[model samples]
Target: MKRTLVWLGGMATVTALLVASTGAANAISRGNMPAYCRGEVSAMYATKPMYVKTGKIVKARDGSLSIQGTVDKGSEGIKAFACRFDKKGNFIDVMAMTSDGE
Candidate 1:
């Protein structure tokens, strides 16, 4: 009985650690997004029904922002899009989109 309890306690500790680590990783992922980008993300959501599945925000060569993400759902059936922004985070244009890799 004592051994079983110890094993169960160890399992619980491991599970809690896993959950905490996952939360931290998620927080780190979007930690770098500029404040203005939040508005753009919200605006994109307003005009459609979808969620960003995965994405990255990077600084462009001209000191702008380049955002690429996979969408869950929208009217155009677009699977992914590359959204561009000026240095100040103003929406520039969607440079490209891909329904499939090919």
Candidate 2:
């Protein structure tokens, strides 16, 4: 009985540590977004429906990244898309919604 309790306690401790580490990693990831992209994101989400849910830096074919997120636009529900930016801080390649349907 005592041995079982000790094993359970150890497992709980390990689980807690893993959860804490994952939270920290997510916090770091949340801010790793490029500065220019943040500003553009702000502007993009300034209007109705469009909102920046989360941003992640992903590896592309060249192992370099842009940014991607799941955005919600009013009753349109949630949609995922990649972000585009130029050296001049221009936002391009915004393929959020389709004119045919949601």
Candidate 3:
């Protein structure tokens, strides 16, 4: 009975650890691109501790992807930008989106 209890406890611990790790993995994988683009845009443009809100991901016919988002610079106002990435998820360029929707 004691050995059985010990085995059950070990299994429970393993299950808990697996659950925690899975959650972490999902969070990282799901938000990897958006988070990465946000960080890059924030660092490149934000002058005074700005806020970055990530938007949808746009795919081009050329197999490239672009992460669209807005950067809020408080007093400096807000601006829209897109972080472009290659097919393999490589950094391409960051462009400021115009009001007319470029």
Q: Count of backbone clashes for each model? A: 0, 0, 0
lDDT of each: 0.59, 0.54, 0.75
What tens digits encode model 3's per-residue C-alpha lDDT throughout 1-102?
A: 999999999999999999888672222233477887788887877553248888887789997888888888766678888988886677777788845234
Off by over 4 Å in 3: 1-31, 47-50, 98-102
The TM-score values for the models, in the order shown, are: 0.42, 0.39, 0.60
The candidate with the higher lDDT, 1 or 2, is: 1
CA shift of 9, model 3, Å:
54
lDDT of 1 by residue, 8-73 (tens): 999999999998886722222234453334345536645332355436688868887777765554
Clashing pairs in 3: none
Name the best candidate (by TM-score).
3
Give the runs in model 1 whose Cα sits over 4 Å from its true position. 1-50, 74-78, 99-102
Off by over 4 Å in 2: 1-35, 38-50, 85-92, 97-102
What global local distance difference test value does model 3 have?
A: 0.75
- Scanning candidate 2 in windows of ten residues, the lowest lDDT window is 24-33
